[model samples]
Target: MQTTTLTSTWPQTLCDPSGRRQAKPRNKGCTMVIDKGIGQHAFADMLSTSGEYIDIVKFGFGTSTLYPLPVIQSKIALAIKHGITVIPGGTLLEAAVRLDLIPGFFRQVLELGFTGIEVSDGTINLSRTLRNDLIRDAKSMGLTVYTEYGKKLFGSRIDVTDFARTAEQDWACGAELVTVEARESGKGVGLFDEHGECREGDLSHILRVVPNLDRLMWEAPLKEQQVSLIKSLGPDVHLGNIPVNDIITLETMRRGLRSDTFELQQVPYSEYMI
Candidate 1:
């Protein structure tokens, strides 16, 4: 078996002046890719090229159910070998729950060798009890559970208090991380407005209310959204729903390689220098 090794040395000229960038095996600043459907060779190529920068890979809605069993299994195996967690979108899980196939769903998911599970109610209505149940159940099956908040409607907005409470409850229920859903376009969902712009006020409110901002993964799919978030929450904020091609670009942004946040590349000797 082959292994992937991440380089620790960063360009000296690009070091953060504040010295706050994080490396891999991190609890925060996670980057999750959304895979609609890519071939096995292409998927393997992606993992070989940028797997270290990716923390999770979501199969994106019901697309997982459409793939050939071998392809799905191969992808999951590649990701697991790279220490990346791979799972189907929460919407697929929701479909199973609605059809009363939750047990079969879990069995099939485990059989497929998926190491992660996303529990979300973006399109359906789930009671608090049911939501917690899903989290507990997934955890019981030895899956890394990632629960999502916020609806997918165009004008939907997040209630800071409710989100905070739900986030805390989900964490207590054994969820590894809670994701804020912004969908693929990243517009008109969660804290984003119609133009794919983030509502700063809403974001600040959530941060103020939530106990640990690190536990929340914001689904930012656009370059501008990624820049704005890195600026607001620093490079350590967990971001998900990232497009496949943008993985390295997002990593560059996080490491101050991009002009959007070039100012972060000035590490003070007192902080980062040994």
Candidate 2:
């Protein structure tokens, strides 16, 4: 797929200052931005400025239902036009399951022009069977499914074995990607301690089980979290729950344009080699 490069002046004399970051329609190095509330004009501005860097646009929480149906449709259409997959928050789907409105929820989302669904159990208990079935159902409708593994509560932690099993099953069932929940706060939750520092042991365990990191989306809402993951996992690791405003900044980091990741670029050593 030929998509636009991050730079406007491609094939220039100088290479990217940071390094070569992948272009759009990328399988790896994808970035998902969290949108709580942004109107059409601002959304348009964001896209025009840094849309190429964004892979997915998530309408966070039940806010997708807060807008007029027309406005929602327009936003989804705009993202789709820019080749970005737009998905409502998994919390909305969780609510549907709670009220037994899964079918209606799916139908309404599709009708509203969402190109994807987030099957997550962050706030509630979801059985494996239902989770699998939900993935199947979403895929059956021709929508992309992104499943999430982790809880929304502050003290909730991930059982490594269960997470591995769940991630495997979700992918096998038809999810395009699986997210490790950090919520928007990114504190005291999956892979993160109370201070929002990543638990290396837990992360290493998941890495050992999964092997490939492409299928995983680490929700890193904080800049520190984003920098740490990008540094540890390399530029291609998929990151989610990013604020809309941070899209360009994150892209810069991925390319080593930011000081936090400046070493990613290949630089020549010394001028004086006497």
Candidate 3:
């Protein structure tokens, strides 16, 4: 399926406060929304309102399997129509791996109109070889592949060395983005501390090792986390696991429309005259 390119509604002549955010089909500044459950109407409304700002919509965890086959197909089809890559959560792949039903899972996902795949082992143990193979296999199927790093357990911190190595290898195996896992809660996992605050040192370390920061997608579900990461990593950083309702607000922040990031925007000469 061909992905459509969407242009921003804001006038091109005006300067954006947070500098210029990239348009749709962008490699950087990508946003992946985590959809737990929303009816077809709400889904369509979301896309119609701010589809240009979204890059992907992930059916969180195993929720995709809970929906009716037709509903799943419709959602995936709609997302693809709007140029958003839709995929079941990586947990589903983990389940398939555990059950030895990888092939069936792949068949079912493609048949359901999913255009992307997320390969993650947050809860399950996955070997490096298996991870590489899964990434390659998905890419060979003409699906966009996103691989995630880090475990889901609370207090599970990121190991800079292992993350660097794994991210490098996943990219080598043809995955498009290496996601940093923060779970849906965005607390006590990966780069976040128990209070949902960022471990700034660890975040810096990761950036230092991964020079191509565009290849990383940080899972920032909370507003604070999102704001902090955007400030720390710049507005162009790719972020995932955003709530469905926050698409417009997040986009605003990226453009420096929100108070938290308003200072990032530049002032016009007329404003200085006042």
Q: Which candidate comes out best when scored by lDDT?
A: 3
State which candidate, 1 or 2, has the greater TM-score.
2
lDDT of 1 at 197: 92
Model 2 ranges with Cα > 4 A deviation: 1-19, 268-274
Deviation from truth (RMSD, Å), model 1: 4.4
Flag the better candidate by lDDT, 2 or 3.
Answer: 3
RMSD of each: 4.4, 4.5, 4.9
Return the clash pairs for model 1, or none.
15-265, 16-266, 16-267, 17-266, 17-267
Instruction: Give stretches of model 3 more than 4 Å off.
Output: 1-15, 271-274
Give candidate 1's error at residue 20 in angstroms: 4.3
**Per-residue alpha-carbon lDDT of candidate 3 for residues 7-67, written as tens digits (9 for 90 to 100):** 7676643446656787778887999999998988899899999799999999999898899
* lDDT by residue (tens digit), candidate 1, 1-274: 9887977886555454335555567786899999999999988999988988999999999999999898899999999999899999999999998999999999999999999899999999988999889899888889999999989888899988999999999999999999998999999999899999989999889878899787889999999999999999988889999999999998888878778978667655685577
Compared with the true structure, model 3 gives a TM-score of 0.93
lDDT minimum window of 10 residues, candidate 2: 10-19
